[model samples]
Target: MTNPVPKTAMTMREIRHQLGHPVPPPGVPDAEVLPVRFVVSSVPEGHNARHAYTINVHYRGEGMYSVGHGLAYADGDGAWSYEPSRSGEDDEHDADGLTWIAAHRFELTTALRLARRLAPTLTVRGRSVADVLADGSPTAEGTQR
Candidate 1:
């Protein structure tokens, strides 16, 4: 019996199938889908406190010359950023176009789930005043936090 495929491999395969693209053979150009995570942090100097949020999602498709798209979930919000930007190359434009559409659909389900969890945290705080300089540089006296 054949060994079970690794979860990472399975995920890649699922993404390819979802995009309706066949797996490429060795030495041939193939498309790839990857799950990616991005974290955003707030850092303050002279203070020990820090806050970070990691966002995880899939980035699929192929290279610049091949038709592919890279997609990711934005940090904390569950919104997806779909990259449909086409690199003007003859070999991969068609494939990339198709992949772009596929990636957008792939993120919808995940985004909805994540959004629900994040909705409660989105609130605005009152504004505070700060100083500025005419040359777009902060004055030395205003540097103190």
Candidate 2:
């Protein structure tokens, strides 16, 4: 069996690049971008400690964005789009004008439910929720209390 990709923390800049979001040039107001914090932890289940995936999703925003999670497509020229779809057809899950801000808001139902469990515990030092969330991991920063 193929080994699962090891869990490595990724920065917003890196994740954004992978998700087809715009990466501003140096000194170009990059702070305005919203970020998505995701982790897919492996939990041992059943006998012999086999691993099961536990996905975590966290983000901070004004709650006015759209996220599409589905199949992704690319043409011969390399341009591509991704949207939620259970059907297997080109243009079946197509979307347009989605921005980086909106992408962070997108969460699968299960992901959202899991996130809510952890969300209450994420605030730190009276800072902006977005800033705390953007710091990237729960253990990365937190208050002693």
Candidate 3:
């Protein structure tokens, strides 16, 4: 078997750039995925944009974030998006373009609010997304207990 190309984790810069491109995003060369909070939403799943599209909110380190076009576009198998890495290091997947906000514009709540506005059906890991930023994973920042 041929050796792999050796993947690298995506930086926020790369993700944002990919999203804005006019053509199409790349599919080959798997990307490393880092662990972070995520939120999901969708109007409906279909064959077209208006009827079928999903949005995802991904937390970047230090209160930064990005909104992806469709369940992150390849977060599943066979495509480009990524699911969070099991280890804090990285995940086996892809990181395509994203519309990311600057670190200054989003704290936890701010990011959540934006995602909610975009998709009223917002959810976090199947639980109520309200106050999800209050507490959870080791990276969560806010009041304790």
Candidate 4:
């Protein structure tokens, strides 16, 4: 699938600045600051295969802290074809997943931002965000970060 968000490459300093983190003065290295990374994945077979897209926000030193996913189907057949023409897997589907992703370019940017903001909160004490969300508030269980 075509990346909904434009692929980006930024240094730690640039990323911190973009995310509103404090920027160090000149000559101050950003080694302690984690570099921000963006990732995307799309699979045509999931429940929302028609519009399903995954967004991942990662920090070099901090690991992945945020993930956002959604399935947004276009009206009618949309602009994508699931034909798999090159690979000849199916006539109905665009054999190249990139074709489908390219058609859903509108939804990626927001997902990236949300993932970035929530990334820092992904790790609470030692448990995962999924764990907390699935099990209820950590404080409710007497857990503290």
Write candidate 2's Cα lDDT for 1-145 as tens digits: 9999999999777788899999887667666555565543322222121111223454545433222122222222222245444343444333322332344344445445444443333333464344533544334124211
Q: Each candidate: what lDDT?
A: 0.39, 0.40, 0.44, 0.43
Cα distance off (Å), candidate 3, residue 44: 6.9
**Local error of candidate 2 at residue 33 (angstroms):** 5.5
Flag regions of model 3 displaced more than 4 Å: 1-35, 42-52, 71-105, 120-145
- For model 4, the stretches where C-alpha displacement exceeds 4 angstroms are 1-36, 39-91, 95-99, 103-111, 114-143
Q: Pick the lDDT winner.
A: 3
Give the top-scoring candidate (TM-score). Answer: 3
Pairwise lDDT winner, candidates 1 and 3: 3
Each prediction's total of clashing residue pairs, residues at least 3 apart in sequence or on different chains, is: 4, 0, 4, 16
Best to worst by TM-score, what's the order? 3, 4, 1, 2
Which should have the higher lDDT, number 3 or number 4? 3
lDDT digits (tens) for residues 32-143 of candidate 1: 4543432222223232221222233333433111111123333333344555567667548768766655544335355445534543332223311111111233223444
